[model samples]
Target: MTVSRARLALGALILVAATAVLTYAATVNVYVQRLETRLDAFGEVADHPVFRRLLDVIGYVRRFYVEEVPLDQLLEGAVDGVLQSLDDPYTVYYDAEAYESFEISLTGEYEGIGVVVTTVDEYVVVQTPFPGSPGATTYPDNHDGVSPPGLRAGDRILEVDGVSVVGMPVERAASLIRGPRGTTVRLTVERPVEGAPPQVLYFTIRRQSIEIPTVQQADMVTPRIGYLWLTQFTPDTPGQVREALKRLRDQGARAIILDLRNNPGGDLSASVQVASQFVPAGPVVHVERRGGERETYSARGGGLGLPLVVLVNGGTASASEIVAGAIQDYGSGTLLGEQTFGKGSVQTVYTWEDRQGRAAVKVTTARYLTPKERSIHAVGLTPDVEVPGTPEQQGDPQRDPQLRRAIELLEQRLGG
Candidate 1:
């Protein structure tokens, strides 16, 4: 266990950080170590009653606890107790190893079964499997081993490799599912039915080097409409979009449909660069810090002015919302589909070390607004045209309600 000091600084409060792979970082043993020789490190605060009380509790636990408690366990408990006192979910800590895994997850590729997942209402649900990966039915493996029907949307993950993950955190569960290439992992899932009992399914999948492109799809949807499905705003995304657009233009596409559904934003810098590719020269987004300091990231000159339709949903958030919000503000595009996922706060990620090991934390550093100064922290962006989602839309692209509406709008614009 790689223990971490997730102690927070509120207006002011403090807490502890968590670790990875169901193996949460070092233990409360860290707290025990902190109080051992660092009591005087508190300076004048050591004389405070609250600090005195905490010292008393620590002393008693060290002296009378049955069967010798681990030194680092109580330290972790103190950190955890601090976490519960805070309200923001994004301001949590991660151990060094876990932090490494987190960085790997965002790069659009990894060694795993190649599926995107999320925890909704405590249920670990499969959002989708990367096409051509072992988790997707579209591709066959070279292993010549037993293969199960690929994963599907709404499949509730029950266990991983025989270990129950019923109550595990999303990141922990995901870590459990990912491993080295060519290795195999078993998954047990519950397939939900609309009006019938859910069916239990099992799969033994071989892990492979999974590459999830930031732009999942790019093609000509019609004689004049080019469609691009972006999964994230990465450093590589602007170039990818540039190429995709060039290809579509070669295919005689004059208009574009930019799909941003289910895009969890990444890299604030990348977001600005991406928006610059579409919107004309102007401020893309405005960010304000706690001290009232404000900064505006503007778009560069020379971008495509093609007729645009952006497909969004509850999963379109962060950097994606920034682009959509800007496009909507400038009347540069039509925002189609459902409302977006509201995540307007910016988090600053950093790392620190302790007597035990290193840890990382995501601290809420600033709040961002649209170009028109609309604060969308908890309130998401509403589309120009409202379209509700339907079941089984993932299996067939033509059946997607949002896409169908976008196509209709484009057809009308193109006079097709």
Candidate 2:
């Protein structure tokens, strides 16, 4: 019962294991084939009308066109064709150049006139300009007393170096104005005045190293009130604010005026970090989607012990809204200024392998909400005290009447 019996048992065990492994491999192959088949079927069914038209064009190229199109060329054409079909201005295909600009934007550095410009209802309008940049200086002489004709925060950029921006894509317009530092870019902008035609005002600005100041500090008329201006929620914005708060505290500031006027916003995590400095250990902002997925950002630890006043305006967007909304909802601060910009959607950038290999896709993945679960997507966040700036007034601290009101409110809180 020794050697032959043992060899037979071992052979039987090996045979069983090999059979199981083969079965598993077969099962996996079948599952993968089925999945691929289903995906192909779904893709055909979900082919948008535009995509179908693109497919028609591709068919024409494959059949009637002269030369054989390279596979890479065909893929790029297909990608561009897909985005063009949408007809939505926001939905766009970024070539290497535009994608590079986007990358620079994320790092908060770009070689431009330091202006964020976009088309709003067929007119090129100036979005928020980075502090100390050319755009901030380009304004009317009446506003803030910053001399020499410069573009204001809300001015319309009609032409770039005499090139008419009308009927041009925003990306093209942006590209035309943005270039290397020390280079001069002339902008023919339209000042928003009553009964004034789109004037040809030239701004020959030499671009410089535009380091965006996340936090600005000033002493109000009430000596006890220290005003802190938070432009955007950048990566180091929380630390900047903490340092500002410390300086304000050291200056014997009893009431704090947090100004968030015309801030188009930045990093979401930075907003949560800034908000965490104000609120107690509780939910600061809750991010949710249409499908019931949820994520809650909570305050870290201690709280700023002072009469807090948050100032917001039309440009206050995304993460700025998050901070402002949280402060207002928790009774931690009083909000002043105009309604916010209301860009509350969260996006995720992903690259996936398809039939054409890997392609980058950025899709709106989630919607943001206040601590009380109030969605501020299209509907902007309204302030407690509404103060709108006139066309004559457009800059910082001084140009914003709303910020002044915030200072006044903080002073009042300090019994000044």
Candidate 3:
């Protein structure tokens, strides 16, 4: 009886072992099948000589490269190369960090020293500083005995954190200057003084969370004329504009001067919404796609019905052009200042998840036309009144001829 019980126990143990082995074999077979399927897909591409050559190079590098190369880095380089081959400046690939920064820009908020910069003669020069920002604040005398505390417009940046920025792109220099809130960035600046040698200055500015105001200045130019300087068209722009218009109307303004000078345009929806405030019910702009499909965007009626004049310049672009074109086409307002920047193409952003986090592609999807079907891709919109806003007259309201002209036009319309 004892022998028979021991035999039963051994038989049960053998059965369990066999089942475990069979399960392991099945799992290995499934994994191998998946790998083989992937190889088959690769094989289809390998039939092409170009792809086969690329595969050969990758294999050779994996086997005999002097230093170890990450697979992700190599793949990213390949993707960038493919996009670069297209040679479209507007179409670009954004890596993880750049993608994050791009997203922040759309929101009109960022952590930085609160200065706007542009590339001038291969130098990153300060355009302006936000009000009450670190860049706007005046500092005490520097170690070199320079007295100025705040960054000034037209100040050419020489270095950031001791790294020379000569010939660096403005975008790259701006990225270096931006950091976490409350941190400090050391700037070496060269200020060009008339009738004197260029002044070399140093400043340590603290970074902060900056909320960029789309409407820079809004006030009554005259008792009957309102002036609104729109810096950009962001998501918050339409609401801000509505409030400004209402306040100006309450102040007895019968006309408006919409300043779009130096306004590198942003959100398209914001532009349409702002245009709807002035333009009567009609098609504002037309979007033409690659396949010849066209769509028209119209104004949402019930505007202020006030006489309006739009101010534009060489810096006005993208959605700014859209707004100006619509107003001009509808005869809702008169455009004043030099021709616009002529960026009439629209870009659509596409994002995707990858093993190395998220990446983005900004591709020019369509070209926009004015309501009259005029293509302004390379040819900008000529103003009804051609007035030049020189660099010297930029910040000086008293000397700004463009603003003076806009006020003249508005006053004439108001019979003031």
Candidate 4:
């Protein structure tokens, strides 16, 4: 063969490849244009400034970037930026792995160290460790080291297995902490103390199947007065409440004390159902959406009609607020203890899958108002009788003034 013949074949190959590339680009352009046309039919979103800014960003990165970046990462960063610009903390973007783990968490069970955690600023802080879990048990005799074995409330988790988790999503940090039962995970935590230097603790905890209960405890605090402590709301909550009420009733109880202190809230539907068990059949909450659309979630079925006192604090949030707000508005229960945690925005979780994997977004689609038509977002519910105290003195009368006051009020109601 000749050099010219080889050169000609190479030129033809290059031409075909170039043609294929141009054709693919054209097809993508056509698809994007069609999408823009569709978007225009609804709200002229294609002409929006955000669309222009985003396209400019993509073009600049693709054409003039020095280092190569994966398309997925680049696109995901863009998606994250857009969501962040909404300036709403409730609206969040979760990647595939994080989203999968998040869905599991909603079921009220998982394989991990049993602790409720939340992100405060740049740290993932422990709300509380479940009773009887390793996180709750401190070393009886600390000859080796001290103050690090047992995780405490308000402890900021800085590292998981020595990898820094600071400034990351709560779900991401949680995923790092979770694993199959019998596996071990090391943690570096910063424990804050009042009027003293903070303590940094190290923990090597074995993972276990952690099942979080909706109703943490239910029993007769007095011979005829029942105390029900709820940790969170879930699908199983209403049933658990029913069972608890039955048990309390069988135990010969007439009055009740419902505790929502430190309850961080959960499923909205479950919250409404749980409210139904206490608030009687009436409007429990009103959801107000953009464009002035409103939805009323009413209590279903007959309530227990027992004289009630609902104990709440700053830890009480979201769905917990819904129940407390309704009970207060209907005069079905007297709210005591500290002010409630004001988290009244109703978030709607939307999940989708692409060629890459699954992703999800939790968007604040509406604001939830109490039955009395009060929005509690950041304003919290003021107790009928405000009493201030810490959770450290949970069961003691003198220590937990809130509990002491609740008892006093219930006694008065019973006495009357």
* lDDT digits (tens) for residues 29-77 of candidate 2: 2234434544554444334565445445655675677888754466555
The residue pairs found clashing in candidate 2 are: 138-150, 138-151, 138-152, 139-150, 139-151
Query: Residue 83's C-alpha lDDT in candidate 1?
Result: 43
RMSD (Å) per prediction: 7.7, 13.1, 14.0, 9.8
Instruction: Give the candidate number with the greatest TM-score.
Output: 4
Could you give candidate 3's per-residue lDDT for residues 205-312 as a string of tens digits?
A: 888998877888888877888888887787788999999999999999899889887676777778888889988887878988888999888888776698888888
Candidate 3, 254: how far from true, in Å?
Answer: 1.8
Highest lDDT: give the candidate number.
4
Cα-based lDDT for every prediction: 0.71, 0.64, 0.71, 0.72
Cα lDDT for residue 221, model 1? 75
Between candidates 3 and 4, the one scoring higher on TM-score is 4
Candidate 1, 124-197: lDDT as tens digits? 77755655578865222232254334676457899998998775556667888999999998888887766999
Residue 242, model 2: lDDT of 88
Compared with the true structure, what per-residue lDDT tens digits does model 4 show for residues 130-199? Answer: 6556555544222245323456556789999989999777788889998999998888887677699976
Cα lDDT for residue 363, model 1? 56
Q: Report the lDDT of model 2 for residue 385.
A: 80
TM-score of each: 0.74, 0.74, 0.70, 0.77
